[model samples]
Target: MANNPCIIIADDHPLFRSALCGTLQRELNEPQLIEAADFNSLQTAVEAHKTANLILLDLHMPGAEGFSALVFLTAHYAHIPVMVVSAMEEPDIIRRAMDHGACGFLPKSASIEDMTAALTAALAGNLWLPAGIDDTPAANEAELNIAESLARLTPQQFRVAAMVNQGLLNKQIAYELNVTEATIKAHMTEIFRKLGVHSRTQAVLAMAQLAINPNSTLEAFRSQALPLQ
Candidate 1:
């Protein structure tokens, strides 16, 4: 069906890529598919095929991480929605991708029905997060008060908070920030207290929303915000 929508599939694994393409072809019937085996291939494909309606991306490619790719596409081509198709079940990664503007995510073990449903939901303009992952960016209360809370953090803490907001686990944050996991955990606890949040999801939602509208001054926020010890 030449009239059907077009999608680009970017995955490193041949078997999964082939299987996913086969399933999509069978189910979608008419949607055109462009396959990319790696990040370079995906970059090239994205440049050449600007008409793609959606992108199905794998997270752990060797050269370029899936998150970066998501950022690139969403920033450069804001009109095209990107969905993550990955095996990673980590809550933080899932949450991070959503914050970075992924339209949805499907685990590698997802059933055929689930995959089709997620894709359909995304195409319909819905954010495709898993059942319990809570893709609702507006559902968290902390997110509603981001501007006030970010001011409570010190410059270093702000850096840590940014990584945390990006969905990095404690260990990953530690590695990225050149600190121990324990340090990251401590910073997170302090962040939660300052932000009046209890969980990672809450912190993420709040921070992501703050990034969207960063009008408040960090110093002005510090003067009025309650101290968190």
Candidate 2:
């Protein structure tokens, strides 16, 4: 596989991963294939193999609560193309994955031919979706806005926000992130300002809203008492 592209198959199911690997081996020209069963390992693999050409990500894998892993990857590793391969094929899910910067979406049930085609297109810098699936109905303006705001966050601030969502206290987050409590507080303040929130609770709530229903409109989000600030 020397000098060939490196592709990651990030899925928790061992059987599915094996099948996908077999298909890739058959379809591709002996590309370097890396396998990860969870989001943490996926991140580590990506970091170690900076030349990776593509990532086949699963939406519900361990350590990837909802679209958070996708969001984190797109935010931090924007250069590597990601193609989501998930069992969930709902249009809304597909649309959201695309919105979060996935280059393509392949349902787990797709045939080997379709998988090959999708992966080829994504590697060539083209977006791919299943046939008959409308690519319109893009993520609502509110969702887009939120994504843009989140993208503005520094990497450390982004990590802090995720910890906040996990209900970690400021001190706990500080210890885990290996920063002083005051440094954590300063990061939280900036995070709140960037996210348009006044308090930690409001900041957490805002992130929760996006996580829960990223496709919802501003009005719908407000209805849940998640008004900006």
Best by lDDT: 2
What C-alpha lDDT, on a 0 to 100 scale, does residue 71 get in candidate 1? 56
Lowest summed lDDT window (length 10), candidate 1: 210-219
Tens digits of per-residue lDDT, candidate 1, 197-229, equal 888766654554433222342343345553532
lDDT of 2 by residue, 82-128 (tens): 99998889888898889889998999999888997898898888899
State model 2's lDDT.
0.79
- The Cα local distance difference test for each model comes to 0.70, 0.79
**TM-score, per-candidate, Cα-based:** 0.58, 0.81
Error of 1 at 162 (Å): 20
RMSD of each: 11.9, 3.9
